[model samples]
Target: MGTFRIEGGAPLKGEITPQGAKNEALQVLCTVLLTPEKVTITNIPDIIDVNKLIALLSNLGVKVQKLGHGAYSFQADEVNLSYIESEAFKKEGAALRGSIMIVGPLLARFGKGYIPKPGGDKIGRRRLDTHFEGFINLGAKFRYNEEDHFYGVEAERLKGTYMLLDEASVTGTANIVMAAVLAEGKTTIYNAACEPYLQQLCNMLNSMGAKITGVGSNLLEIEGVDSLGGCEHRILPDMIEIGSWIGLAAMTQSEITIKNVSWDNLGVIPSTFRKLGITLERRGDDIYIPAHTEGYEIQSYIDGSILTIADAPWPGFTPDLLSIVLVVATQARGSVLIHQKMFESRLFFTDRLIDMGAQIILCDPHRANVIGLGFKSKLRGILMSSPDIRAGISLLIAALSAKGVSIIQNGDQIDRGYERIDERLKAIGAKITRID
Candidate 1:
């Protein structure tokens, strides 16, 4: 196991050029399976999750080449989709929940797709029912045997139709979009997750000849094509990273410039955080965080001013980053009620904050009311192990801003999505060292 030992209360400075989005890189890499022609992806982050997806693709017989830094070329003359039942497949596939994403493309193109199970954050009861529902609606037959916990999908030809997803699951929406791109007719996906990742997927698919409209909205209109071709695409900067850095700068009272942030992709995140009394300045492609802003009070409703942060479907605050918001609120001067409606187990980590001397009330499984004691000035650094990717980074931000020293174990969780995290923080003057 690896750990991050950080001497806290060091203000982070300098500029950090954000890496390409890891979530987008997964879908773009998997899209190579949809065509025999080579597809080139630029600005891909060298992260753990992206590496695992590349390993999965290579196992399936895609020729993956690294063309020097952050660039790669992938071509699948013939994909060995049959070998997915091997022990190696199960071990690696279980390591990343994003492995579930390949199921739809495999089934649509090869008529059968097998996966033991998808692994990801244990935040809550994430439903694959929406994914299965989309495929079932597209005429794919599914069989699940609890003995092996493997899911098998086979279809002669996927006939596209209207699909009303049970929830706006991020990957669920992505899985169906991949399956529908080559189906027989138009696929009308209602209640879809139109996150920036999905938009990137759609843009890549469109460049590859799949006709898709409504790129950033909830309702997606995907018109099936006979097959897709190859095109070059660059993944966007990570929005979750943007959120994490914002929290980091505010908590440490650092003046940092985050470069190349896709301002348009942020949608409502800026406004959502502004409600928390965080100020940001947009200078070209960068967002600058000023130093030494006192904890501004959160704005409340018309009737009463009780601060609240809620995560909803896309165009709303992302549920994936509500943990970041919760962590940031711990140092603010006011109180905030964070509602994580989609996942039941996501809020369980509030106890860890309580351990770190944060005044948080876990109202329920999905809600936590945090009353910031106005920069408590004394966080007794403790040994804490990371639980998941986003939560792990949140803890790192918390650790970096604390008064004393902290040791964070299971650093691989943070490595899963973030690239060069320790080095990047160090470049910004954070006193962090990675140890094994």
Candidate 2:
């Protein structure tokens, strides 16, 4: 365990580049399993979850060579299929939720895939039914070992067909797409997740000779290729991190220029913050947020009802940013309801904000009503523990904006996603120190 000692009230200013998308990195790294040739990927975030996946790939006998900073070439010419049955594989595979994605590509290329009970942040129930169902739909036989809590899928040869997913699950869609890329016939996936991550995966697959259409739409069509080859891919900047910086700037009244945010793919994230009265300017590929001295005021609906901010699937406001939004709302001028529709426990971290003297009403497990103090009441920092990746950053933002020193334990959770967060924030003039 580690702790971050943050001295609040210092305005952070300067430019910081966003790390590569963690979600996208997971999908792209897993796609390397589909091809025997060298796949060179750049802009890979140096985070714990991503590193774990890379280690898992290396353990499975994929040749991994680090080329430079945030770049690697992976060649899976001789994958050790038997490693999946080893106890070490079970231990490594269960370390992160992204490990489950290895199943699809492995099954597609090697005819078999297995996953131990995966572990990740305990936010809510993240079911794997969508992934398994999609695989089964493509003619894979699925089985579960109740005693070991393991999942296995096998098929002689995958014959692609049509599958309408129950929801646009991001990883589920990625898994199915990777599996379908090398299947026998044409595969049509309706209600697929069209997040920039998936689109990048499709583009990378296309570069590797997989025939895929509908790159940025919910419905995707894939004509299975006999094989895939090496391709170079660069991941987009993490939009969730960009949104967090927006919230951090608002809360601390900082002038921050977030570089290369891929503004077109950010969807409603910018406008969603604008609803909370946070002003931002897009400079080509970057987003610049000036220090909010006039104080942010929540914007009500046209009919004059209180504003409600909730999360949805892609092209909608991401659930990951809701925590940052909730923390930012603490310093806003008016009250707003934050409904976290995706994860039930995500809103529970507001209790720590409430303890820090923010006016927050925990409506339930899934909703929070934040009454913005508008800087009239300043938050006094205290010792806190991080809950998850997103909430950990939210707490760090709160600590930075508070009136006193705050110590946050469980800093590993934050490092799992954000790459050297304290170092980056310090570069932008934040008063943060990491202690092991």
Candidate 3:
């Protein structure tokens, strides 16, 4: 674990470029296993989870090459199938939740895939049943080993069919798409996750000679192909990071411009922040946030009642950005209720904010009521530990806006998602230093 020593009460100003999307990178990286040819991916975020996936790919005998910064070429001409059963793989694969994605491409190409229980943020019960059930629907035999805590799927050959998913899981949809692209017949998936990440994956697969339609909708149709070739893919900017920067600017009264944010793909994110009374200007593909000297106010509903922001499926406010929204509301002019419907434990970090003098009521494991201080009360910084990736960045934003220095431990969790976060924040005039 590492720590961040942050000097607070400074306003940050300058332009910061958002890194490649971490969630998208995980799905795209796994697709490299679907082809034996060279798959070149650009704009790859040099974060811990992504690098770990790449390392795992190398260990599995994929020909890996680092072309340059944020660019890599992978050729899975000869994968060492036996390594999937090794103790090293079991340990390494369990370290990342994204590792489950590899099972799809591996099963598509090699007729078998195995993974240990994956690990990620302890937000809620993220069941793997959707993924395995999708596989089984595509004619794969799914099995789980209770003694070893391992899940395996195999089939001599897959035959595609229609499946209406129980839930529109992003990873589950990506996994099923990867498998169906190489199956014997056509596959129709309704209620699929149509986020930009999945759209990019489908586009990349199309370039590799896979037949897929309905790129940006819930219903996807994929026709199985004999084999797939390689193609170059450039991931979109991280929308979560862009939203974080917007919240950070409002929290610390900073003027910052987030560059190349792919405005079209950011569904409802900018508007959701605007509902919190945060002003943002879209300059071409970038977002400009001016310093809020008078501070921001939460907008009331049409009924003149307290506003309640909740997470929903695609096109709704993402559950990931709810944490940033909660943190920013601490200094707003009015009260708002944050409902994190997807994750139960994500709101537990609000207790730390309460210790810093913000008024927050934890209604339950999934909801919190925030009473904004309206800049009348300045927060006093204190020591805290980061619990997860999004919470860590939210705390960093709070610390930068506080009255004194604060020490944040377990910053390693933050590095799992953001790329060189401290260095990037430093470039924007934030007094944050990473301590080993």
What candidate 1 gets wrong by more than 4 Å, as runs, is none
Tens-digit per-residue lDDT, 1-436, candidate 2: 9899999999889999999999999999999999999999999999999999999999999999999999999999999999999999988888899999999999999999999989999899899999999999999999999998899999989999999999899999999999999999999999999998899999999999999999999999999999999999999999999999999999999999999999999999999999999999989999999999888999999999999999999888999999999999999999999999988888888889999999999999999999999999899999999999999999999999999999999999999999999899999999999999
Tell me which of candidates 1 and 2 scores higher on lDDT: 2
- Superposed Cα deviation of residue 197, candidate 3 (Å): 0.9
Q: What lDDT would each prediction earn against the true structure?
A: 0.86, 0.95, 0.95
Give the per-residue lDDT digits (tens) of candidate 1, residues 299-335.
6778886877888887888887899989888888788
Alpha-carbon deviation at 304 in model 1, angstroms: 2.8
TM-score of each: 0.97, 0.99, 0.99
Report model 1's TM-score to 2 decimal places. Answer: 0.97
**Candidates in order: C-alpha RMSD to true structure:** 1.4, 0.7, 0.6
Off by over 4 Å in 2: none
> In model 3, what lDDT does residue 109 have?
92
On a 0 to 100 scale, what is the lDDT of residue 31 in model 1? 85
Model 3 weakest 10-residue run by lDDT: 311-320
lDDT of 3 by residue, 18-126 (tens): 9999999999999999989999999999999999999999999999999999999999999999999999999999999999999999999999999999999988899
Residue clash pairs of candidate 1? 97-119
- By TM-score rank, best first, the candidates go 3, 2, 1
Candidates 1 and 2: which is better by TM-score?
2
